[model samples]
Target: MDNPGSQEVDRIERQESRAQDLHLDRVVATQPEIGPTPPDGGYGWLIVVSASIYHITVPSLLTLYGLVILRAIRDEEHEEEESLKIWDMDLALVPIIMLVIRLLLESWCRAVVKIFNMPRFMALAGLCLTVAGVLLSSYSTDTYSNDHIVNVFAGIFAGTGCALTGQQTDVIITHYFREKLTIAQRLVRMAPSIGNFLAPILIGYLCTVYTGDVIVMIYAAILMQNCLFLASYTRPIYIEKVIRTTYNMLRDAADDDDEVIYSNPNQPTPAPTTQNPQQGTSQDDDNDVVVFNSRKNAREILDPAVQYRERSEPVNNQARFSSDFSAMFAETSSNRFSSNFGSLDVINYTSTSRYQELESIDRDSQNPQPLYRETTVNAPQNNIVFATEPTAGTIRRTATLKKNLITIANMLMDINFYLYALLHLSTTFSILVLGVFFPAYVWLQVPSQTIWWVATTIAMGHGAALCFLMMCLVLPQNINEKTRLCAAFCFVGALGFYGITISGNRSFLILWCMCASFSTAASSILQQPLYNSTLNEFDTTATITTTNAIVAAFVLTWALLKNYEYSTCFLTAAILQAITAVIFFALSFRRRR
Candidate 1:
């Protein structure tokens, strides 16, 4: 009783719907599963402990060498007319070299990861290099005629090693402690202060007993402790990437079908036809999938209204699709889908269930739920074992490099970043000046017999600063307040340094040390506010690299100067501190405006 044309149309519609459903099922099946959620505590705490130990040991050497080892070297090599200058310059280059190496590694971190796939292996390599550098330096002191050149070689090794170790620690910490990251960072930050407090006293005492070369060997031995701790850096439980490739492919296919059906109203919807596998036309379908998946945010994909609005736009189908496809996937051919029929676009495929759970948790933040849920054998769980399976695919190194360059350029363009960088440079310069010259100043002021007392006083000052930092963590402070406090501390420190220049009285010196140490510690704590106020996009690695480079430049300039006199150095530091205080005060006012 039905017309033959109508019957044909009904059959075509049913066939198309069935085909679409079948395609969606295949796409869904091909999607990569999400990995397990981070266990915020348990094993994660072990990682925190490892990172803390690293901060305490590796970074503490910087202070130890500056305060204790440098002085010992000066005494041992005192016969050389320019030994002091040469040693100071050589040591100053250590940090500069380290910064340069760190910058290079960070810039090409993706490539480095490819080369050293496992974080633990990278860390082990670093440890070996560091120990080798220290041992080499110790050997150079005794063996080499031109020890400075050898020292420089040692610096290169040490710098590269430290950078690698530090990078892996940061990566692992971030990987392990997602939810409890803030807590872990606070705990880790405390380690440096403890190291700063303890290293001076311990090393100073050892200096009384051992020679410089022997002490260097001892330090190398201590660094070996990192090997035992490296075991704590368990492989980061892999999480599935949250990619929307499957969704995008489905959306694009639907859109293409819609376009075909609507191209001419007079014509009936054509029956779905199979294309020849040998023909090159399937590349067009692959291109469509790539173009649609270019969108970054999941929210955009989830919003039905947005999709409807996009479909309504009067875009030239072939031109727009081709342009978008080229723009998105032109960087790498691997991003494109395979030419075979029914084969899903596996590029950028991510775990769905994990993404949903994380999204849901973010939405219900007020009533937080456990990250992991119990699953049954029959229940659907799309967990991917990242260790066994390649999560997503190899990231394009060139693309990442280009992106980082763009980000750095953008940061450089911002006037606020420059201000923050200057502030950071000033604070670091002051800290370095103190670390490098403070012991020498103390030695000149106090009798040789009473040097231990001065060292103890310095240690106590660091302890006081540690307490102040702990207090700052607890006390809720806005950016304005932190800036004001930093300014005040700088002023107080300037006064303390000026006090030291005027008189060498033991009691007064003790008071000055405490005041100066507290102020120095404040610089470390308060720089956070300066950074927050200035940077629109806060990148930890980039910010650190910029600040370190600035500080290194200043330190190099300082080392080049002929003035090694304790009084002159103290006066210069005081003047710089006062200038920094004024700058901070000005910054605070500008922020208010």
Candidate 2:
């Protein structure tokens, strides 16, 4: 038989070894399960092609068709049908209606995605509705008022379909692209220019030849078939199941033991204990478990080797003390500021673990200087890093919905929202004045040159879009600088619009149109990346709020300016744009500093 003291020592040693093994296992379990890499190319190209086609066909077609319908209404046979006063309202309302639906969808897209499982299904449904609407419009042989109602229904279908389909393309591209994302985005953005140029001419000719009803039927047939091709390419990935499985396994393991391994090194160490001779066998056994677990935890975290290594290192005591003082002051100030902001606070949560702190110090010591630096390097982990996945299990849908709603609310509270909204509003006003009123103004100025007006508008818009496409290809993806550059360009466009007010010559008008259009196109393209950058700087991910706010601004400004004369509207647009540019410049400058 073994000696009693030796037996007790052996039992204690075994328990200590078990505790270390448990600690090591916990560390190993904490590592994330890496998922499949995104396919940067391959079948993604087909999706890109489909997206291009959709972009080229849908938006351009609607714009062209709207204008053509307007023209057709104006040119309607008086004997065949009564003139409809609602035609003008129809022309303006079509795009506005489309925009409102798109905005609404955007606001709730994440929830929709969660509920529907995929945007592809929504897109397919939208396609069906679009076809139905077009068919209804085509088949209708009702009075002017009834026909107008049918067209409004058609507008609804086209708007919802185009929004859903168009947005899904963006989602797909973002999922696929990584390194050449800018190039892919540029191609996607540029596709609409082709539609913009060709759609007007094609739709105008088709209306001239076969009537608008025939044109609607043709669009219905073409889109219904094209949507099938689009739907075929859309496939969903099931990484969520894998993530859920991994999470369940981890959680089960943790629940198996009452005393889970504590990874944090900063917590106060528990006192060591020994089994009491007078205590019952079960109590003695429990005491042994607690004593050994506490001993092993302390040894692992507060190892003599690590402590000596840390103590032996050279440090400037003055600098260390200064840094500590500054960090304390900063923390106090941040807490005060956060209290003021309440739920929308910019929380700076540092890991309280000494292990993490030591690791960070080691990294800093190794890299005296890094070639590339992220602004968030010195920021608290919670500020920039989102813990999207939980340690327990898959996040509940209810929780996700609540979280997304909170994010949206916080984003609305951000100052950047107002600034971006202003910028978008100014740009939108200019585009509206150019698109709706410029042609009419040209007709008034030179009724003999109606053909020239159509040609010039198409040429200028397409050319400007092409120029922006080239810029996208050539320019480096510098989001901050691009925002400033785009702002400057917008200012130039504003100046051009202002110049139009004073000028009477056709050459100047054409030149101004070209300049203004080019600037607007460049600004529009750059705004996507610019908005992304601004969101990053704000440390928020609520794109829908930004979009909604911008649209709201547009709606407000449009309401104020819609009844004004074309010249007066343009003049107001210029003034507003000039103010926006100044504010943007100042804000950018301040940010750089």
Q: Tens digits of per-residue lDDT for model 1 on 1-593? A: 98999999999999998898765323323344533455578878988898888777776666655555345544544343232332443444444454445544543453475465587788888888878877766644331233566667777787778778777776777666655665576667567777778878887776777765677788889889888887677564443222355567778777652221112223334445557778533212211211333333211112334346456655424232232333333332222233332333333234333334554454567876544322311223443223232334435666778788888888787666765666666556566656656665665565343435656766776777676667656544344455567788889889878887786676677677666766766676666555665574756567666766766666666755564655776777788788878876777766442
The C-alpha stretches of model 2 lying farther than 4 A from their native spots are 1-35, 73-89, 131-152, 216-222, 236-413, 428-441, 450-457, 496-509, 537-543, 549-553, 556-565
Clash list (residue pairs), candidate 1: 35-240
Candidate 1 residue spans exceeding 4 A from truth: 1-39, 67-117, 140-146, 238-410, 450-454, 477-480, 526-533, 538-544, 561-563, 591-593
lDDT of 2 by residue, 303-330 (tens): 4444564465453232321322223334
lDDT for model 2: 0.58
- Whole-model Cα lDDT per candidate? 0.61, 0.58
Candidate 2: give the clashing pairs. Answer: none
**Every model: Cα RMSD to truth:** 22.4, 21.2
Q: What local lDDT does model 1 show for residue 208?
A: 71
Work out candidate 1's RMSD over C-alphas. 22.4
